[model samples]
Target: MDDLFRGKHHVKVDGKGRVSVPPGFRRALEAADPNCGPERNATVYIAHWDGEPFLTCMTVRGMQEMTEQVRAMHPGDPDREALEEFLYENVEELRLDDTHRITMPKHLRDAAGLEGEMIFGGRGDRFRIYSPDVPKPAVSRLAQQMSTRPAGTSPFALLPDRPRPPAPGPRPGE
Candidate 1:
């Protein structure tokens, strides 16, 4: 299985609102966008939903997938409109610079209460940026719950199985 983004990084936000993306996370972003290169910087969509204490950053691919899922809903559905307003209307597409840094928009920074220090945490196809002052009790709870899982049992074992390739036979010479 493809290993999506995974890690936690602490970065400093300069007075200009610029923050450097962690090297590993930068690589993950690049990998998520095949078209990204030295000449073309990868773009991330930031969304600060109502009542959320952090900003969610998603790769272009993730954003496209979310958009597609949203489009699949009925055009006149209230839920669809609310989702669009919350996700699409509130999102800001920011392009990484050559130094793998981006200037967090004023609105987002203010909404997330980001100051000198911020936390960037990877979450598979997306990531979240939180203020240093955010609480860690939820993280602790999740770790506690995960530790209770029975040994040799995968958390995903209950999920439907995906198709796998057939085993290859030995060569004729062998």
Candidate 2:
């Protein structure tokens, strides 16, 4: 969840609602690890859009893994078919043009109501597209939300301490 993109770039949406995916962000997608091969191709998954008036782009890897896991749980059940369709249908396969711009299709643009000014933020393995017209909540307000958690709210914190819990001790019968 902490996969927030560190690179920031300001860009505008054209009259057609198409916005360029800054080269820096494209590079961010190409290299999941900062120090890796210079591959340029990246898999992109355009979700239906979420989080109050914003569109979210998830890494193709993230989307595939999530879909596969969910599908596996249901076996041959038809219930998962709908989810599979939803993910694939909404996902927009993307590519960088000669100018290194990742085009946003008209349908997606319309879905998110993007017009002129927009904000792009790296969201872990994917990215988020937001209309600049919308006002974002102040960081201080977010900090306050984080500060109000219950004391033992964490699962890991509730686990009993195993004071050295008997070592391997020669596996069963040494």
Candidate 3:
């Protein structure tokens, strides 16, 4: 999964709840998933972030990679059932148009309290679209949590394990 999706763009949440994904952002997305078929079923999992309800998109492969790791760690054991349920409940699969637009579901919009202005933020393997006004407490809390967390604890730890590359051979001419 690509880990460098950082950009900013204006988005307008239309009356029908569709947002115009910026062309530049779309290009970045296309570059990330070159093998995605022509009729892209860009499976995305959006969530509210940075004080607003923002949409996040990712390829299905990315999401699956994430989930597999979680399964490895927890395995849906009774002790981890809640975590498993939370993961299942939050992630969503959506289709993106050839135009690179995604229609926000009403429940998601309503949960985020999105109305007019929107912000699309590319965050590596995923992107988040946020409402104009995000709750200050939420923002501060996330900042504090992120700041306090240990460096090794990634959100993707629950995903399937990736094979570590082999060590480099002896230096050339050695």
Candidate 4:
């Protein structure tokens, strides 16, 4: 399976508005952006949803893909401008320092209501940092569903496993 951002981590927000990125997440970011190394800082784009108490973060490559999608829209389309404004105006580029942490800007911290502690949940190519008060029933529900799937029907069944043949059954005249 491809390397994916997947996990839930709790991190403390310091008085200075800095939060350390989980180590595993740092590795994932490095994997997503191969150009990043010890000397080169990895870039992350953060966007806070209006009226929502969370901030979505993605690698520079992911943000570039989103920008390309918006650029594909017709120039005269009104929605295109709105999307461009919403994305370009609200997004902030954060560079992970040597300590693997970034200072959250005041606007983003206020939008997400971040304070003492926050939850960082990975979602495929992106991740979200949410206040501790945010409800997480959806994640639990997904876990339940995955656990209940019948054998051999898991989405990950294509991964390498012990080879098996079809069960034999009576055929022809019996």
Candidate 5:
């Protein structure tokens, strides 16, 4: 929980599609990948699903967690097959260089229209890379709505309520 990917970064893409990975994100990636050390560069999995305008990037452990989830489903099930495809296909494994940059493949760059300045927005365990020219994501609108809610309201309210313990029994005096 302490190593969550947080904040946003704006970086430029070079002709060869190499871009600097933010230091904070690099640390998180290193923490998630047990194989990473002074002798090894962190390996990241980049996933671009469908025609989405951004590439989803995560550490090896993150990808493994996704794979495990998909694997839990029944074999040959329609949804399971789709999930397997989602986890296994359309992904590129990239390793960070000593300079802390990753050279994204041309196809991945083209699929996301990634060029010029890119927005690397953190999404907890993973991050998304996209061009700044595109329309704002729908979640941004939800963020705007957040301001209207009461000051103490938390976004976690959107999730199902956690179970509560039973009230304590009354004392003998009652």
Candidate 6:
């Protein structure tokens, strides 16, 4: 399997709004950015959509892939327009520094109501930066769901254990 982003990290947001990314997450981000190496900083795209309570972080390559998908949708489609706005206007590109930290812009911090300690939840291909308070109604729903998951049930049990098939080849034109 690929180097998936997993686990949760509680990170401190500094006075200047910089947050050091967890080492594991940094590795995945670097690997996903094709041009990143010792000489180049890894790039990240953070989406601060008002519909969500957290900032969604994506690797440079991952954002590119998502952009392509959005571009393929019909121009007049409302869903496409919404997705495009979310992908473009609401997204901020931040490059990781030598210490693998990115400075969260003031606007983004204000949008997510982030300060002090932030929660970094790895979500496979991407990760999320959430305020400690997690004020969204979705968080309440998630907590309720967790409360109802039968006692002694393992979360991993929900995932299929079978090995994944290899990824498909590139499109014919490309």
Per-residue lDDT of model 6, residues 83-108, tens digit only: 98878898899999998899999899
lDDT of 4 at 63: 80
TM-score per prediction, in order, is: 0.78, 0.63, 0.64, 0.76, 0.81, 0.81
Instruction: State which candidate, 2 or 6, has the greater lDDT.
Output: 6
Error of 3 at 40 (Å): 3.1
Cα lDDT for residue 17, model 2? 54
Query: Per-residue error at 107 for model 3, in Å?
Result: 0.5
The top-ranked prediction according to TM-score is: 5
Q: Per-residue alpha-carbon lDDT of model 4 for 29-128, expressed as tens digits?
A: 7776766887897778899768766888888778878889889999989999998897889899888888899899888988888888988888889888
Error of 3 at 19 (Å): 0.8
Q: Any idea how many clashes model 4 has?
A: 0
What TM-score number comes out for model 4? 0.76
lDDT of 5 by residue, 54-91 (tens): 88898889888888888888898899998777777888
How much is the lDDT of residue 12 in candidate 2?
Answer: 88
Alpha-carbon deviation at 7 in model 5, angstroms:
0.4
Q: Which candidate model has the greater TM-score, 4 or 6?
A: 6
Identify the runs in model 6 with alpha carbons over 4 angstroms from their true place.
Answer: 135-137, 140-144, 147-152, 160-174
lDDT by residue for model 1 (100-152), tens: 89999888899989999999987888888998787764323345555677776
Report the error of model 2 at residue 84, Å.
1.7
Candidate 5, superposed: residue stretches over 4 Å from native: 138-174
RMSDs, each prediction? 5.6, 7.1, 7.9, 5.7, 3.5, 8.6
Which should have the higher lDDT, number 1 or number 2?
A: 1
Question: What local lDDT score does residue 117 receive in model 4, on the 0 to 100 scale?
Answer: 92
**How far does residue 27 in candidate 6 sit from its true spot (Å)?**
0.2
Provide the lDDT at 141 for model 3.
35
Instruction: State residue 61's C-alpha deviation in candidate 6, in Å.
Output: 1.8
Q: Which stretches of candidate 4 lie over 4 Å from their true place?
A: 1-3, 137-174
Task: Name the regions of candidate 1 deviating beyond 4 angstroms.
Answer: 1-3, 138-174
Model 5 TM-score, 2 decimals: 0.81
**Rank by TM-score, descending?**
5, 6, 1, 4, 3, 2
